[model samples]
Target: MSIRAARERGRRETFARLERKYRAGEYEEVEAEARALAAASRRHSRRRRPLPQWQARVLATGVAVAHGRGTEVLPELEALIDELEPVDPEAHVLRLIVRNNRVTVLNGQERYEDAETEALGILRDVTRLAHLTPLWRMELSALGALAVALCGQDRHEEAEAIARGNLPRAAEPALAGLHAVLVRSLNGQGRHEEALAEARRDPPHQDRRDSGLLDLVTAEALHGLGRRGEAEAAVRRALADCERHLHPAHPRIREARTLLGRVTGEGPGD
Candidate 1:
């Protein structure tokens, strides 16, 4: 098999094993395996004939994200991008993917401005592409990131506009995340009634993290509308759902806790 194919096979096998471990409730083992795979990939990349440079970096990035080391991988991804040949279309596509990953990392780190900047750059590059048919998925991904980053920055109106404009094209399962971004932007702007309405239109799948976020937005909107009883219940549900699915220190969990505190009149610190 070609180097790329071989690398792909390895990735698929590793992820399959990790998924099985996760399904079996072996989260600690899953995390350990993912971290080990990330380290192995990084070490392997130092070899003279390691998997293609971009492929190795992409593998490392995926592993970092899987292991909850998103922020830690940003510098490596950035350096990889700096070494790419910008004139090559393949390189350009890889750059977009890396930048999208960077946006994700920055967002997770709560660096909204940096995420917004990187996302905007990705969007601009997407526009410059002569043919977007092959890049449609990445384009939508960038747009989703841009919307989320805008919401993070409290530029809700702009975020809402972007999400609304792209919602139609986001019919695919992979693109459904745009809906969450839209709902979040609406909630951030204090459009409580509208946010609640949108959150219900096409609620996120129960198995997805977005579902927990949707609950959080619902809680926030209900609270803003002075429905304290409903808000408290919703916030508690959000907290429970997030705590069950996300890391203890994840930003989403922290936000849910803060919201619950507000709804319960206990303050976030308490």
Candidate 2:
């Protein structure tokens, strides 16, 4: 098998094991194994991607997720900036993109403040790339998404400035999707009313019935607006849809059940 394929398989197994432990109520074991896997991946990636530091940083995430520490991969993420700097001028900054989703997940799982603070620092420095690379447009779009993560952490003023200052050349409407996430970030910070207003501003791009992830986010936004009844209904609908339409092992389904438990005040394992 290819190296990528082998690495991917390891990650898939880790997620499956994590789900089983979550159901079994094994939280301590869950946290430990997650930490170990993350550590090992960092060591492996360092040796593998010595030049482009971003790729090395991104590799650790795959390792973290594979070991079921997907929710707490920040220490590894901190290495992104070092890789981004004059550390390697030849690095493909635009292609160092998947890390964007790791930042996005950090916002969702309650690490918003940390994710936001760090991402802004990167935006400030990536200006170095804006005038030099052929993929300025792609990198700009990525920076916009990262800005969204920062914004959703209740850094609206910062998020707006980050997006406006850097997004003039981006092709994708990444900021629009981020606005949806901001709805939750605001809700987390006791800005529920504002979050509700933003949630209503656009038809969400992530409302597909077959994807539990979209449903969970929609449910959280709804729940935040004192629409708990609708959130419950949405979670049930997502679970039903996935059980019927998607693979039983799909990641979205696992996340939906976890979020549903949090929303309904009863764990899905019940």
Best by TM-score: 1
Best by lDDT: 1
Model-by-model lDDT, in order? Answer: 0.72, 0.54
- Tens-digit lDDT track of model 2 for 1-270: 999799778677866776467334454465466556656666666465543234334544534443345556645554554454443544545234435545555645657666565455545545666576554544554565565566545566665555446534433334444444455455555666765566566443432222344455567767776677888887788777766554454455676788688778887532
My TM-score estimates for the predictions, one after another, are 0.76, 0.48
Residue-level lDDT of model 1, residues 1-270, one tens digit each, is: 999799789777867776666545455566566566656776677664333445545644644553345766678878867766667676777677777878877887889998888888887888888474377777788788888888888899998999899888765433557877887888888888998898788564543334367788888889888899999999888888777766555567778888888888899532
Provide the lDDT at 255 for model 1.
Answer: 80
Clash pairs, model 2 backbone? 11-66
